[model samples]
Target: MKAFSHERAPDGKNEWLTPPEIVQALGPFDLDPCAPINRPWPTAARHFTAEDNGLIKPWEGRVWLNPPYGQETIKWMRRMREHRNGIALIFARTETRTFHECVWGVADAILWIRGRLTFFNVDGTRPKSTGGAPSVLIAYGRENAGRLHLCGLQGRITPA
Candidate 1:
């Protein structure tokens, strides 16, 4: 799959965004904001940005969200709930009570991948796994439902 759109890291030295860096910053996700609208993927399937929550409004279509891995993840989770027509890639923070209450509780489908995902380099190079944490893909609506079979992540099924 393609990567998401991102500027250099806050330090301004990286120059580009990579999937692994994004996974480090966000989690195992596949959204690339810098992707051209007419790319073969049809639409943007993933977004990797710390500003994802604060900068954008509700969207309609296949969406990917790898938001910040911070306390404010809850806010982004809330927005994911609001636009229930896409997929969201998030970290499985088993230790956090808020993630359990806000994300797991509201997601339509969850995918617990078997291993840590390797996000790509800004130039599309693969990076080593950043952590041992598990990742998840939370599906929300019908279109997103069809993609679950394609992705094959394990999680309990719930009605939307």
Candidate 2:
């Protein structure tokens, strides 16, 4: 199988890192199941990186996922749906198959972020530019759903 890594190279592609503020907005989670080797922000004490085959690993507890942006997103979203706990950061592509199959009705809450996010660079520094697309935060558990409601994120929140 191809390596479905999260960190986009310095190749000027759109492998945007989840902004630190966005991660902080949801508060702390128990595991970042699809993190890079050196994460830009702290999401969880435990992480299952792409090298560890996070897609195949058993995911439990409050999870946080900023999954790889392409087809790999389907797999991570599926797992998040199965785990049914924690928050996931993904593009707000409601028309995509991944969103309909894994997110639409599965998430407990959907937070439509107010604007495009600025991702961190591969070296873990703040990027000078904002992301190419709008983002959404999805909560799978009631705790996260409540957190999404009161987390003070600049977005519109709707119950799923």
Candidate 3:
């Protein structure tokens, strides 16, 4: 159970990379507006770092977002809702306000990943521990919803 908790560094960082398999399954995206340089997967043709302030940039084109998982996640979720053309990987905390506002009713489709996924570290290595919480992949547009339908991932697909 300890492993399930996304332990933060002393600096309040819960930055974990999405598994490459999940990336490959759902994408072929255009931009990873929130990717750190050390991320394991090549999320898109263009990516932005923390310094780039992806929230300020136009999230144009097919996007793949695995935004920081902290208090700032709400900002990223707001950005995604604005972009309206991408896939987002996030914790399936249905009771959270972000889920209710940003994901539950707004997303065109949602795939509740069956179990807790093991996220990678900045070094591209799998973390020794698996997350305690389950995950979700939200499709922001109809095209992405279609992609989710055909992505071959195990989950329940709910369309809005």
Candidate 4:
């Protein structure tokens, strides 16, 4: 079976990048645990690409996570929850088991993006269309939650 139905990569690639605007809005992050190996821009002060096995590395300071989108996403979510000092960008699939397990009552706050996000390519190029589904920013700590609230992004933040 395919990892995720929304994965529309025809080339069997999974390196879709987050838009720079979002990062610039709520950024100056200390670490990006699941960053791409060859990114056009910096997601955080430090990054851990696939080669680093970010899931197994030590996470410090404020984190920004745009984890691999698939079954393995849960593991990354759980780690973020445990780290408790970061913000995660993920699909707004609120009813999924992953959301129930990692978000819901666990997240400090959630920002439901107003419109579909247009993820960029590894080389900083954008696709003509937006992502297949809605997206959300899940804050794991109070500081990050405040950042989300003041980020000025087009979203509705629900504090937990």
Candidate 5:
């Protein structure tokens, strides 16, 4: 299967890295609470990997979260909502309960990426195929919402 497919990783891991260009466009973020441990590039000034259990850590500054997919995503989204000062990259599963609970009316804005993203590997290599699903950038604060509005990415931004 293609590495970018979120269904299941060929490497038997779910720790896909976010494309650096996307991060660069929306940064500079102070923290990446769900960063991969062996990333080839820095997503933020500070990072918390799986071992760090970022959900319980003290989150400060503007966060850049590409949280773990699947069931655990809700927890990260909840945390982001509470932090109320950051951005989150997740699959555009608009009908999911997580979206209703943590995003939607709760977030400051939403940017629907024009096309599916091809995520990077932990080693920073590009994938051969694009992701199985579309993605969205959720802005939690006014500054982040403004960043989404003018990030220059090909996407439609909706303010809440």
Candidate 6:
């Protein structure tokens, strides 16, 4: 079960981290837009699947997430909050107060993707599409999002 672990080393070839992946690796995506998954509609590791929905349920342990890039982001963020154990990778849109409250306000950490990502479709197939927007990885509670070290990626929001 090879999930989309964002820990690719820089060994050249297809191992180079794209901007969206980079942002996910970063944390507290506070300065960019969310990147859409690359490809058309259903790639193996890009888009959401029935398997994902099943796995990300209201479990009382660590979790994974790659939410869809739409108005429903807030819904997904809320779901993560309910779980208490979550690591959600989603697009970063500063304008969304709902997103900010659920993800940025409550989340423990945030990663800003440096580039775009082409999300996959539902059938685990790559879509013929690309997104130029940046993205973010929002971690719910205090835990690792994808088994990656949070080091400098740790972030917090202080009231002004």
Tell me the tens digit of each residue's lDDT in model 1 across 110-157.
666566555434444444434334566667766565666564344544
Q: What TM-score quantifies how close candidate 3 is to the native fold?
A: 0.91
Write down the worst ten-residue block by lDDT for model 6: 8-17
Candidate 5's TM-score: 0.94
Q: Per-residue alpha-carbon lDDT of model 3 for 1-160, expressed as tens digits?
A: 4543675622235667888889899889999998875665588988998888888987779999988876788889988998899999988878777897799779999998987788877777776677667889999989999999999989898874
Could you give me the TM-score of model 6 versus the true structure? 0.52
Q: Rank the candidates by lDDT, best first.
A: 4, 5, 3, 2, 1, 6
User: Which 10-residue window of candidate 3 scores lowest in summed lDDT?
Assistant: 3-12
Whole-model Cα lDDT per candidate?
0.49, 0.79, 0.83, 0.88, 0.88, 0.46
Task: Indicate the worst ten consecutive residues by lDDT in candidate 1.
Answer: 1-10
Query: Ten consecutive residues with minimal summed lDDT in candidate 5?
Result: 2-11
Clashing residue pairs in candidate 3, if any? 4-132
- Whichever of 2 and 5 has more lDDT, that candidate is 5
Per-model TM-score versus the true fold: 0.59, 0.88, 0.91, 0.94, 0.94, 0.52
Kindly list the per-residue Cα lDDT of model 4 for residues 1-160, writing each as its tens digit.
6534568542247876888999999998999998878889999999999999999999999999998887888999999989999899999988888899999999999999999888888877887777778999999989999999999999899975
List the candidate 5 regions with Cα displacement exceeding 4 Å: 1-5
lDDT of 2: 0.79
Tens-digit lDDT string for candidate 5 (47-78): 99888989899999999999988889999999
- Candidates 4 and 6, the one with greater lDDT: 4
| Model 6 RMSD, rounded to 1 decimal | 11.3
lDDT of the structure predicted as candidate 5: 0.88
In candidate 4, stretches whose alpha carbon ends up further than 4 angstroms from where it belongs are: 1-5, 9-12
